[model samples]
Every structure is written in C-alpha cells, then in structure tokens.
Target: MSNVLPRAAALAAAALLATTGALVGATQSSALPMAPTCRVADLELAVGGPQRAGGAIDYPILFTNTTGHNCALRGYPGVSVTDARHRQIGTSAIRTGEPISTVLVAPDETVTAVMRTNSRSVAPNCRPKSTYVKVYPPNSGVAEEISYALRVCGMFEISPVEAAD
Candidate 1:
C-alpha cells in the first residue's frame, strides 16, 4: 500500500506539470501581435513615370498606405491599361520575377511594383493604346485609376511589390 501511494503521487505531479506547460504556451502564443491587411480604401495609388529601361517602358506604380495602422501585402497587384472610355486596352498585368514574401507597410509608408511593357516591340496583333492604368491592390476589389500616357502590348508584365524606401 505504501509503494502504491508514492507511485500515484509521482504520476499526479507529472500530469500537473504537463498541464501547466501547455497553458503557458497557449498564453504566450495568444499574446503575439498581429496586424491588419492593407485595403484599397486605405491606400493612395499613383504612377511615377514612363521611364525607359532597355527595350521596355517601365512604369513605377506606387502605393501609399493612408491609414494610421500597419497593414500587410503580398503577391502581385492587378493592373490593366484602359482607354479614355475605361475599356481594357490589353491583357491584365501578369506576375513576373521571383516570388515575393509578405511585406508590412506602416502608416504613410510606400511600396512599388514595376509594370514593364514592350508595346513598341510587340507585333501589331497587340493593339496597344491607353489613357489610364487601373490598379488593384493585392486581395482588394476596389481599384484605383492612374492617368498616364501609356502604350502597352496586349500583354503586361508586372514585378512583385517591394518596399519603396
């Protein structure tokens, strides 16, 4: 009987320690901070310029977070060149370059994605003319329009979004 009591007490103590450790881990995990994702409504979008890069015309698309909170962005922004009547002038921008990881943008911070077009070199099959570029931020439905003199082939190549500064 004496031996049974000692063994049972040891088992109870071990179980208690295990339960305590699990609780501590759960508490720590729950305390970790999390930021919200950036939305189209919380951002201001602009096109920098039609800079010439080698054989392609590179347009630096800038996104500025206007909200006061930090937000996260990942992947590519949807881009399409549009005519004066808002008609799509070409195929939407396709993702290019290496895969990008999630980027956090603090309040008033900016991020950029380069849109490269070989409109001047594309075959005549690609009818390329546009008065504006419509941009959709990652994971957003609301699009922002940027007016710029852009000529693109029926296809667009877009680099992944990266930190501007």
Candidate 2:
C-alpha cells in the first residue's frame, strides 16, 4: 500500500507539471512536443478589409489554417507589396508592436496582423499601385500571394500575428 501511494503521488505531480506548462505557454519545448510552426502551404492567405479612415489606410492580413492538426505561429510574417508580375514594389513591411505571443491555430482557425499604411491623400504618387501583398509565414521560406490594391507609401507597419476573436 505504501509503495502504491508513493507511485500515485509521483504520477499526480507529473500531471500537474504538464498542465502548468501548457497554461504558462513556455516557449521552450516541453517533454511533450510543441506544435510545429505553420507552413505557408498549410495556410490560406487573404488581405482583408482595407478600412480607410482619416489619414491612414488600415487593414488586416489574415492567415487561415487549412490542415486538421494544430500549428504554431510566432513573430511577424514577412510582408511586401508586389506588382501584377509578382515583382516586389517596395521594401518589406516594417514590424511594429512588442512582446508577441505564440499562437496555436487549429483547423479552419484564422489569425491576423493589422497593417497601417499611408492613405492616397497622404501620398499622391506611389503609383502603378501595388496589386498584391506577398506574405511569407513565420519561419517559412516559401511565400503566399494575396490580392491587394493600394498605393502604399511612407512607413508601412504591421503588427504581430494575433488570434481572431
């Protein structure tokens, strides 16, 4: 009976540790493996909602997980404006915000990064306007192209990936 009690206590302690690790969202790989980083091919990308207000054109670049398994995303996605011929039109988007958290995306779930850019009224001649936004998902070498129609100028800033509410 004494031996069984000690073994049970050890098992309970191990379970508690595992649950706590999940709750804290530790970046380090636990004994249980963490979800792999999301791949570009595993996602459906879209440039959504260019909400123009005042002097700014604001929008969200959305990433939808298409796979059945959960995947992880951290840090900023690489973003650049590209022309119809798939040539990069300008410098890559600058990242804004701090303290990004890892997001575990489940099947069909979406995450977004808000973008802010100059309005047409704010920058008149950034013309031959960009036709699309090129996206490289975090840690991915491959890219995804999404439709975008905007004349981007000045500092184009993007926030970190966040879970869609």
TM-score of each: 0.73, 0.78
- lDDT per residue (tens digit) for residues 35-118 in model 1: 777898888899997887666678899989999898878878999888889988757888886688677788999999899877
State the lDDT of candidate 2 residue by residue for 82-131, as single tens digits: 89899998788898865688888889999998788877678765646888
lDDT of the candidates, in the order given:
0.80, 0.83
Where is the poorest 10-residue window by lDDT in model 1? 23-32
Query: Which residue pairs collide in model 1, if any?
Result: none
lDDT of 2: 0.83
Candidate maximizing lDDT: 2
Candidate topping TM-score: 2
Worst 10 residues of 2 by lDDT: 23-32
Q: Model 1 off-target regions past 4 Å?
A: 1-33, 119-126
- Scored against the true structure, residue 53 in model 2 reaches a CA lDDT of 72
